[model samples]
Target: MSTRTDTTSQAGARAPGQREPTAPGFERLDAEYVLPLRWSEYRTGDVLELTDYLVRIAPNLDVTVVDGSPDDIFAAHHQLWADLVRHVKPDGEATANGKVAGVMTGIRLARHRAVILADDDVRYDRPSLERMVAELHDADLVRPQNYFTELPWHARWDTARSLINRAVASDYPGTMGINRDLVLELGGYDGDVLFENLELMRTIQAAHGRERRVDDLFVGRVPPRAAHFGRQRVRQAYDDFAQPARLVLELSLLPLLAWSIRRPLRLAGVAALAAALAEVGRRRAGGSRVFPATSALWAPAWLLERAVCVWVAVGSRMLGGAKYGDARLKTAAHSVPALRRKLTRADGRPGRGRRSTTSRPR
Candidate 1:
């Protein structure tokens, strides 16, 4: 093994304990790798320490923690792409480095067929990287399901508001290994690569003409840096949970409008009134005959709850914006392109490949 770093080598080499054996006249499937970063709340000087920790823990995974100010780095060393994020800026903008930044770097240096865009805050255990890499044989993309590591009180409140976001993910169909070509083929977040999970799923679904797949490739638990009550304290932007709105819109409104003429409001109204009258009559009869005791009281509560649910459904149908996020980045979907250019500039670009020698170890 040799001790050197460069764009090509850093991105392409295996970790300390890992071996990079290639058949004669054939290059290994390993591609260039990168971790885009722009720390917020966490101190700047702590970055090197963080990278050092990563190297120590998984030296096989070469990481460069690039600083936003100093553009200079060893051309041979693994590059750590960096950017500046401010509290004043929107949350999404502040953390927009990984998608475009890391993706772009991988595109530049990787010898492997695939380039992975990973997050810095995520903790990858010993088997994690290998598993994700292995997934490439079947699919183009591999998005690991992430568990919450830390959180704030407000964040917990936000999470609780959404009914569908309780678990790591909803009970959907088969695991999808989203192909990279599917994403690139679709031009992936063309205007803004600062995408959330749902956006990624939608993109995959759109390109492949099928929903995104799920798998158990990467299983990450809460790291020590994460909060003890991580699930409750974690706060995500409103835009991150896009499913709620889409689900509500599709389930509530589109069907109503499409079928309005056939059923008609008048017909629905008459049916509802009839149902209500029937319900009241049954309750009255049960109060006097069947239950004769609890029905006089329990029936009212049951009816009220049912009525409220129906009312909410009607309103949800009328309103388009039904889903909510802990924090919302209320910008036009159209505004992504303009924002993407700015983020790409902030992330900067990687240089050409560099070569370095490793120790001639057995």
Candidate 2:
């Protein structure tokens, strides 16, 4: 792989893996990849810890921070990260989902074809980082599993969600590795969706691109604060709208429980079934290594929470849409058929081609 200069900042003059003053005592690794860490914040609480992680990984990857913070906070972030990484404000007009704008800007500013996109709370060590980049060699998009580093009570409660997802299907994670050229070719995914990660994955698949879900490749994520976790309950349940089957099942959960109320044994059996499914998931894809054995016990509780929250999400939808950033977003994600139609229209345009000609090893 070859390195390219980052036109977004003067720091691009330095070669890939070049050490900056802030990143002392760490030698640059021989990996050829770029990491686009995209985030938007009105506050600066996580800046210090995130900066430390960036400094350590700066020597291994060409890092770019696409910040969507207010001017003052953005300036503060630039002052801290300007030397160790390319720091830039998110370009282009804002969208309903601000994170997608930052992600698009970071991809546009990325210096390499192999790009790793991550949220602020994601932390990748050298080994996992390298493996993600390597996997992108044969895939258009790579989805890795995420495990929280420090498991608080809330984190363990959320772990049950991941366990159930692992049992049924791949869990959607905070980070993904992508081939920049392919995403660009697809003209990027919709920025108006609530579940942006799922939107991106479906967009890739709709374009007939290869998407590799690496269940065994675990990445570390910083758990959200308890209060933040509390706020996300209904919003997280609303994401199920993206998958109709899941949405229907969750919507029916309360009614099912109510019907089973007359028979206590049936309610107990339902909870046991949920726990058993979570346990099966916990035991899949080496989940036992990163997920606690006790996480399965929380599955029934998580399901109950979702049973109520899904109704709240429905009410929010009926009122208008879910509140995201400064706007309300009605769609969770575009259906695959809808995305395919959009891709077809793009391909039919005079200057666009049906697919990108970029070569990838099979």
Q: What is the per-residue lDDT of model 2 for residues 144-192, given as tens digits with 9 covering 90 to 100?
A: 9999999999999999999999899878899998878878877778888
Who wins the TM-score comparison? 2
lDDT of 2 at 346: 78
TM-score of each: 0.43, 0.86
Specify the poorest-scoring 10-residue window by lDDT in model 2.
1-10
Off by over 4 Å in 2: 1-45, 349-362
lDDT of each: 0.35, 0.78
Kindly list the per-residue Cα lDDT of model 1 for residues 1-362, writing each as its tens digit.
Answer: 12333422342333233233222454223432344444433343344434433543334433333322222222112243221111011112223323344343333333445544444555555454555555555555455443323433322222222112212233221122344544544444432322344444544433333332232333332232325233222122223224455435334433443455376774455445434433343233121232122222232232233333434434533454222222323321323233334334544411111121111101
RMSD score of candidate 1 (Å) = 17.1
TM-score of 1: 0.43
